[model samples]
Target: MTISSTPEGVSVQPRHIRFDVSDDLKSFWHGNNAFRTAFFNALSLQFPDGEQQFINAVRLYRDRIEDPKLQAEIRGFIGQEALHSREHKSYNEALKARGYDIDAIDERFARHMKWVANLPPSRQLAGTCGAEHYTAVLANAILRHPEWMEGATPAMACLWRWHAIEETEHKSVAFDVYRECVGDERLRRIVFLFVTWNFFKYTFLNTCSLLKTDGKLWSVKTWLGGLNFLWGKPGVIRKCLPDFLAYFRKGFHPWQHDNRRLLEKNLKELEAAPSAH
Candidate 1:
């Protein structure tokens, strides 16, 4: 795809970390809010399969890339996402052991990715770029707001934060691949619109499925609390609107937002923390 040069001061380094999720880890690991916790867990269910889709989408044009740095970043991006898929599978398995039906949710998501795999390569790459931007925006929010993961169990929090750090690190790889290979601005925007719709719709449906299985779907308190958490006070999703909309800018680049400092800080912390690789 031959991007002219990598984004200034931005590159991805893959980290392999082993997170030990406790046997007692509950489904409601985040602040004891079932809906909030379920929402994040639903997102987790998407990753094992979703990440493979991203990897395949980017690899379609890998040989076309001419820049050494971008090529290295692509490798790093693939490696990081591969590890994420593996660890999230373990995380989902832990949830399943807790009696949650996360494996069913993951299987359904895998079916969706299978459909995505059948699309044209350009369309597939565009979809990957769209989802990467979504992840980058959300990762930026998680890095910026400590309260988002407040009260989460230590192991669970470490896993989420680690994923966020690596997502931030490789946020632009797929977008740059699309820009360099497809160069279709209109198609990119249109695909993002579609991806936005499907992303939210599926996430909502998945969260509901999780909630239903956990016997919290009809809980008014759970709904109210979850709604408030996402759209009200702390407003993780609400506060991300600006960054999310920035994706549509004429020369939108993930590094333009420049949250690399957060990634750096996190890497340092994780390196110092006692953990197995």
Candidate 2:
């Protein structure tokens, strides 16, 4: 399949905004709901090392990409992901300071990523592309529906939305790079299946670990509520299934599921709320 370009009007620019996620940050910051808060915290824990993996995977093909525009996007992708890693590192530190065993969780992910680092460069890039699609799908949902952040702490809300906006903007960078360098559709599809499995496995395990630390792991009410939130009304993951599955299509491209309007609207809102960042 041919490489699909990032859509016009979508700019992969980095927003160097620092969030105030300090020690005083509440453990149940999402509407005082342990499940929701733990769910998001679980994601933050993965970003630092995960973002670096993405950066490294894309950088493998940097010199081979002769197109000036794609090269510029590579720089932008690396910059945005680097800043993401920094902010999430600080965010995760706050979680650790709050007495959660985030170090263990972080180390677990770090170990898995180390294994990924040893894979063939093309496989690594394919994994990056798969992970990017996952983020882009969830990012689009968060941007399209404001209620996802309804009860989140202001700073946390802004940080996540900013992340969502940028994820939407640069969703196609790694995919483009992979297409240009490898263009192995079968490999991309197969790797995406594995990525999907690990994504859910680790996210669930990490969320459970955080909840257990909070003494909410055995709370049936917490499990029921969190399960409902993800699979019942509003069904965030359920809603994303179609978009996630699209990656397996023969000629699929990240830009094919364009949501630039959502990106533009959320960006304007984010810019207006400078203090939120």
Candidate 3:
């Protein structure tokens, strides 16, 4: 894949930091609320295997990428994602210790990724680009709107914010690689639709599973509050709809959203926030 151009002025550096996700951490660590806690926990459950798949997909085309800048960014992307996988694994272990059956979900996700690995490399990389878009938009939402995480415990908040910061940093790496290698706009959009369906389907299912394990699945109040939190006032997912749809535009690029200021702003806050260490 010949290099076109990298995102201007964006540095993709990995931050090596650890968080205290010990067994003593509360099960309902996000605002002491079961619904919010399960939602974030479900995301944490997906990261370890999902990120490894991402790294592998990108690696398939790494040698073909002749552009030095894109090559450098790919290195940083892999480094950051490796750390994300490590940290989220620790976080998910805490959930498992709390009796959430995380192993079942991990096994299921592993099986699904095995299937994905059999697909053509273009499809795999396209899927990675799609997933990266989801993370980028969600990261932008969380960083741009602090209220989404307002009531979370400091340790958990720091971990997520740090993840968000890196997500924002390298959001365009996979897409740029995909463009340079495949450049199939139609295929990219089609695979993005498929990725979108599976992303929400699994996240919702996993959240429900966690809630069931917590004995809160059948609680009407839990569903009501969770739905409202997602779609009502200060709706985190709801507000991200526009950014998510932007991926489908004819000349869309991840950096088109241009959240560098937001990234820098929150990165500084994350650095100063002692809980992040």
Candidate 4:
């Protein structure tokens, strides 16, 4: 992705996540697809409250931050999250229309964000940055997982793709802010590792929970499909893990990700299509 310097302090246009599914349940990996929806729906569910959490955390340690760039990045994060919430709200409604009570699942998410929001800025930033990394990994993972994603709703993949782009784009801003504000590598590292593990555990449970709500939990077919997508895809993990490890490879930051080209390239194609964008 080619990097363009934005007057607004280097930012990429937001990408939208759309859920794609098969026309027929018989033709698609319904459980996996539904589970993925819950995964992101969880994010959307948390968006408003999550931003509140960020706002509160930043306020809690407001005096610690002075960089205009960091401040701008925080605003960007809030804006992106707000947009995510709005979009996901619509998507969640779509799920509800399809007979799923997403808000029931959403309640737990709201509480979690509230808990995160109440933390100190340093810890808050560390936790958030860490979570974004997990998203980066998962997004890249989905792009790589062809079997699970194949016959996948163009809409669904696009949702994950758009989210992936943002995750890739903003992967390091939080860490940078945390490093600058708190200067606690050890704590940040621990938070990073712990948050990511939590991301997986919580996400898996939430995904499965929603699928069960939709009556599509844990079939061997879906489980196998999910595995096939993560492990079998070529150049997928290669593309993903590099970004993860790239953080520590020297002079890494948000701009270093520069996934703009990939996001734009994919978006150009995505926007033109009926299901993507």
CA-only RMSD, every prediction: 1.8, 1.6, 1.5, 5.3
Mind giving the per-residue lDDT tens digits that candidate 4 earns over 129-203? 666665666555554444445545556655656665565555555565565667676676666676666555666
Off by over 4 Å in 3: 1-8
Tell me the tens digit of each residue's lDDT in model 1 across 83-179.
9999988888888888877767777777888899999999999999999999988987887787888888777777887888889888888888888
Q: What TM-score does structure 2 among the candidates reach? A: 0.97
lDDT of 1: 0.83
Better of 3 and 4 by lDDT: 3
| lDDT of each residue in 135-212, candidate 3, tens digit only | 989888889888888888888788889999999999989998999889999999999999999899889989989999
Best by lDDT: 2
* Candidate 4 lDDT (Cα, 0 to 1): 0.56
The ten-residue window of minimal lDDT in model 4 covers: 1-10
Pairs of residues at least 3 apart in sequence or in different chains that clash in candidate 2? none
Query: Which scores better on lDDT, 1 or 3?
Result: 3
lDDT of 3 at 156: 78
Which 10-residue window in model 2 sums to the lowest lDDT? 20-29
